[model samples]
Target chain A: MKAIIVDDERLARTELQRLLAPFKDIQVVDEAVNADDAIEKISKHQPDLIFLDIQMPGKTGFDLLEELDNVPYVIFTTAYDEYALKAFEVNALDYLLKPIEPARLESAVNRVLEKSKKEDTPELKSGKLKADDQVFVKDGERCWFVKLEDVRLLESEGNYVRLFFHDHKPLILRTLNYLDERLDPKTFFRANRKHIINLKWVENIEPWLNGGLLVKLKGGQKVEISRRQSIKFKDILSL
Target chain B: MIFSVTSVVVFTTRLLTAQDFSVGMIFANMVNISTVILLWSAIYFFIHYFENLKRSEIERLVWEAAVKDFELKTLKSQLNPHFMFNAMNSIRALIEENPERAKTALTQLSNIFRYSLRIERTETVPLEDEVKTVEDYLALEKIRYEERLNYNVEIDPAVKSIEIPPMMIQTLVENGIKHGISKYPKGGELRLKAVSVNGHAEIVISNTGSFSEEEMKNSKGFGLDNTKQRLNLLYGSKSEFNIVNDNGFVNVILKIPPGGRQNESYNS
Candidate 1:
């Protein structure tokens, strides 16, 4: 797995790199000094995993994750931030404290390896987000690593996009138009100007006013397909 | 019985001496004796009451001092875990890059830890010793922050021997880095200058950053608050502490009166 280490301190970055030397499967693709640098490096390499420090000069680890559309697996690295630790505990996210123990590092890497194995069945399709891909959503103090397949609906509110999955409805800073271009069209269909419905989650559909269609999701969410898209939806579904 | 006997003696004496003992004279003598007794009793009770009150007041003050001393010790001994872990990580990395410098860095880290532990033993330390500890601190931070953190210490020899509250200056300097330099992307400079002026030790710590009153009000300034409380407890209103922003630099000025307070329990 390609991994990048992000920390403001050169010593800390070098130390992490030294520790990961024994892991043959995990390749250290690059190192970033801060959040902006990490963002740039992440886009360039598209690494499968990242060893992210929670504190930096400009932006924090959470801020970096919030910016990404499809977040890679993150194993947070913090010195001893009590607030960040509480967030990680609440989310059950993996993290390694600084001066990391080799035994702990081994376990964290192994956990990520096992998770990647379960998701290996999905083929990477033309650089677009797949159903098995994970996206990080943080709301207030609560954060979750949600899979694309689990999200039943994406509703637009102003410039933010609210994702509906299970019982959570987290608003991410993204536009519905921007998400529509990135999301796999075969799985997520743009229902209207403000709503995007996951095709696999469709439960029942009924004809509605103005030749639009009212579709019910398995999770009981109702979405109205626009009159213009209903014909396209029917053609796609019937075929 | 004494009164009756005295009256009988007076009556006999008057009869034997063949003198006219009037009722007015007897009444005047009785009044004089009662007045003397009342005066004696009133003085005795007042003395005892005041002694008890004074003793209790002293005890209350002593108890308050003890509690404050315990709190100061706890506050002084609390080394920031964030700084400690980051320093350790930096030293660990240095071990492979330069063994000699890493050893020195390790020693610096140990010295800081030892200084904090020792601060619990005394309320105040010489300016010289505190400066040495601060140097060790900035040295380690310099390693962690590298070129991003720059610091200079200018201590006047006259004030080096003057004693100030332990960790007072160090805490301020740490704040300069945590809230000031660390917040900047390119980082900034930190300056610590100590001088004697008008029988008081004036220590000023300046860092490159803008202090926002709004942000400071929103977030509880833990280190700053603790330092203020500590200074108030140790020196009362005698010590001066002021923080201000001047031309994008945050300056924390602390003034300690000469011969800073000497409490037996705290000193020991």
Candidate 2:
């Protein structure tokens, strides 16, 4: 996996690169000294992952994540222990304290590999999805390992998407288009540009104005299905 | 008796009485002039002495008042910046995961700034306003701690209008959360109670945590120390601050005079 290291400290960036040299699959595409430089390199290189530092001069790693429409998998590296809880809250793929251990780095890489393998797997004959298929969301002090099935709807807000699950609605740093590509197309239907409704969670459906449809989910969330996607919705659900 | 010889002489000179009358008038004028000079000297000396004493007393009072104002301003300045740093840190943590909650925290933080900027200009604020500011601070901390923090406030309506130092309760509540509750694994509860007793407004803040003798002795941390200094400056002998530990709980109690309530009501 190609990755970039973003840290203000020169020694920190060098140390992380040295430690990562052992993993042949992980390539150090570039290194950035701050959030702005990291953003530029991330757009240019399109690295599969980024090893981001929490505290920088102007903008923090969290600020970088907030700026992006679609964030690559991130592993946070920070010297301060106070931010460990907050790192977890941001749904970081992994967090490494300063003077990172080799074992920890290996474990994080293994998790990424495992995720890639799951993505590569072929579809099963069974219509029901497994619990292992989940999405991670971090919003400040709260985080959740949400099963894809539990997510009732994805509401778009400008360049971000709000994940509605349980009693919480958390806005993730990914656009609706990015989520559409990642989610399984058969189970998660794009109702419109602004919304994506889970097919299994839909409890009631009715026709609306201009060939559109109104869908009510099991959790009582109602979403408007646009006229453009209603034909596709019918074809998929055969309704 | 002295007039007998003079009367005989005056009778002989009766025909020349006009000259004698003129001499008598001249003597009376001389005595009057001397008396006026003596009275003017005494009056000038008295005015000079009193003016010097009054000038010295006024200077001393002005200097004392200035020093007291400086100390209060310093304390107010320190409290605001400290609180602002913590609140911003909390807001940063909340922004990504719970934007809605973060927004609420930001709003509360704004309220704190509003209160801080105005509080220092006045000697006291209504007990109700002070409690509201404390609640805003606690709400921000609650967002940071998530489900770990809880608080309960019990204040009598009578004392709500009673005025005390602007940040008295806020400082204590902040200490309860920062020094007491945040250190624990499961976090702890903070309770604020206010009551009026014998024309004095008493505020009690209790939190579930214990501080050892060592921590209390150090006492160099800015929050509690500033709170104590501010209390002393504002109320002097009339105010009291006591910290007690009983059954693993730390409690802080403060009391201030109730006369300032009317002054605060008009200002608010």
Candidate 3:
């Protein structure tokens, strides 16, 4: 598996690389000094896993994750930040403290391998996000790795878009038009100017005034399809 | 019962001395003995009560000193594990790059840990000793921060023997690094100067960063507040602590009076 190490300290990066030398299955692709550097490298290499340091010079590891659209499997590395450690505990995520022990590193790497094996999906080369693609969303102190299939609706509010999935409606720094372009048109339908509905989650559809369609989602959210989009939706559904 | 014994003794004495059976003289002698015995008892009890009060007062003072010592120890223990782990990480890397420097770095780390542990047993340490520890601390941090951290220490020999609270200078210097130097992306310089000013050891630690009101409110109070309480406890109002943002630098000044060893006698 391709992996990247992100830490501001050169010595810390060197130490982590030395420890990972024993694990032949995991290859260190590149190193990033801070959050911005990590973001740039992550997009360039598209590593499968990252050993992230929570504290850096500019932005923290969490800030880097929040900025990513497709977040890889992450194993956090921190010195002694109790607040960051608490977040890991709540999320049940893997983390290694500094002066990392060999046994703990081995276990963390093994867990990453096991998780990747369970999710052995092919990467989409078409540049469009598929139903299997997972996006990272962080709201305040809470974070989630939400799959596109699970998202039933997305509503636009100014420059941000709010995603509805599993009783969560956390807003992300994305626009509806941008998501509509990136998402696969076969699954996600642009219901109106303000809403995008997942076709798989359409529970009830009824004709509304002015020939528009009213759609109810499985998650009990009501979305109105514009008259022009409703005709296209019926054609796509063949009804 | 004691009253009766006194009365019998007094009556026998009166009878023997008078050589006659006189009830009035015997009763008068018994009354006089009773009054003398009461006066003696009052004096004895008063002395005993006064001694007990004095002992309890001493005990209370000792207890208060113990609590203050414990507080100081706890404050010292908050030596920032973040620094510990980061230092170890640096040493691990140095092992491959420069082994000799790595060994020296290891020694420095141990020195800091040892000093922190030993400081709990004493309230104040000589300026020379504390300065050595702080130098070791800065050397290790220099390795971690590399070119980003630059520090200069100037100590006046006159104030080297003057005793100040253990880790007082070190703590302020650390604050300068944590809140000031480390905040900048390009990093900045730290200057520590210890001089004798008007019979008081005036130590000033200045770094290249701003100590704005917003950051002062946002930062955790454990380190700065702990330093304040410790200074107040050890030197009462004699010691002075002042922090301000001047130009582009944050300056922390500590004025410690000589012989600030209030808790030294408590060890016995």
Candidate 4:
């Protein structure tokens, strides 16, 4: 497995690289200091995996993941344990704390090798969202590992997006545009700029103001479908 | 000059009316006596009214000065050495293990200090700003407590524009952790929920910690008392605070009036 190490600290990058030297199957392709450099290196190398640091100079490791259209397997290296839950929500392979325990690091690498093997096999892209497909949402101290199907609605509030699932709503540091690209278009419909409704969760739909439509979800929350998105909603729903 | 004329008139009348000189002298003596009495009464009333006004003005000044001093001291006392000690310890742990996360934690710590120091000079900050500061503080605590301490904050976007007393919610949250969750072996959850209800903004901090009656009675932390005093000074009877224990959880509720001159002047 080919990999790249992205960390601001030279000592940290060198130490991690040295630690990985014993794994004959893993090859250290390149290293970058920050998110921009990582992006360039990642695009150039197309490595199978990345060792990401959660915090950096400008963009965070999470920010780097946000920029990617297809995220490779990631193992987050951070000293703060607070982000462990959040990193899991982002579907990180594993989170290794600083000083990098040898046993834990070996386990993370083994998991990567296993995941790569699974990816090599051909598989159908199923319509139903799986438990492994998780979205990141941070609301104060609570971060959620939300399945795409579990999320009933995505409401836009200024610069942030609110994910509504179950009884809790978490505001994530993401824009509607950012979510629009990553979400599977078939299951998640952009009802309007202000809202993205899960297609399977829509309970009823009715005509509303100015040729638009109002979509009521299984949870009984109403979302307005704009004239532009209304057409798309109808096409997807076969109305 | 007016008093002197009255006195002169009295003297002349007294001299002229040594005996019963004439009816005119008697009338003049009576007029002189009445004028003197009227002049003295006017002078006495003037002095009394002005003195009362001056006294009230001085009283108001002293009260305001005392309140300001108390607020400053309370803010300082709340964000003292203990908070720094905990934060530094967390940073120390992060520095050796996770340099990147350590850097992020450091940045967050700086933001908390900046928000706190700026608020020390302010009477009330926008509710949005206060919420942000509390979030920063909680983020730091999350680093320390890790998974043991979890929180959920739900705030209405509309209420974000409203004004609230600085450090009011932070103090409540701190107290919830210190007196409530910190004692628990497994630790517990903390939640802050804000909503606009019935022309008032209601904030509730619910934590998964139990408190006995004795503990409740003995809850004499300076942070809680300071928060109560601040609420009283800012909103008087218009704001209310209550602590309730249910099942195995403790919840603190704070309610403040929605609309008043307090909002207008605060934004200004």
On lDDT, the candidate that comes out on top is 1
Worst 10 residues of 1 chain B by lDDT: B259-268
lDDT tens digits, residues A1-239, model 2?
Answer: 77999976554576677789889999998999778899899878877778988766567677777665445667887655465556475555488766577899899888877776667332323323442355456687555556677888999998889989888899987789877876778788999888998888999999999999999999998888999999999999874
Off by over 4 Å in 3: A121-125, B1-73, B261-268
CAPRI tier of model 1: medium
lDDT at residue B202 of model 4 (Cα atoms): 89
Give the distance in Å from residue A81's predicted Cα in candidate 3 to where it truly belongs.
Answer: 1.8
Give the DockQ (2 decimals) of all models: 0.58, 0.01, 0.46, 0.01
**DockQ of candidate 3, scored on C-alphas against the true complex (2 decimals):** 0.46
What does candidate 3's lDDT look like per residue over A1-239, in tens digits?
99999987788888999999999999999999889999999989988999999877767788898788777889999889888777777678899998888899999999999988998654835677888778878888777778899999999999999999998899999999999999999999999999999999999999998999999999788999999999899999995
- Give lDDT tens digits, candidate 2, residues B138-186: 8877765556679999999989998787887887787787666655546
- Worst lDDT run of 10 residues, candidate 4 chain A, spans A121-130
Poorest stretch of ten by lDDT in candidate 2 chain B: B259-268
Please give the clash total of every predicted structure, in order: 0, 4, 0, 2
Candidate 1, A1-239: lDDT as tens digits: 99999999899999999999999999999999989999999988888999999888888888999988778889999899898888888879999999998999999999999999877744433677889888888898888899999999999999999999999999999999999999999899999999999999999999999999999999888999999999999988998
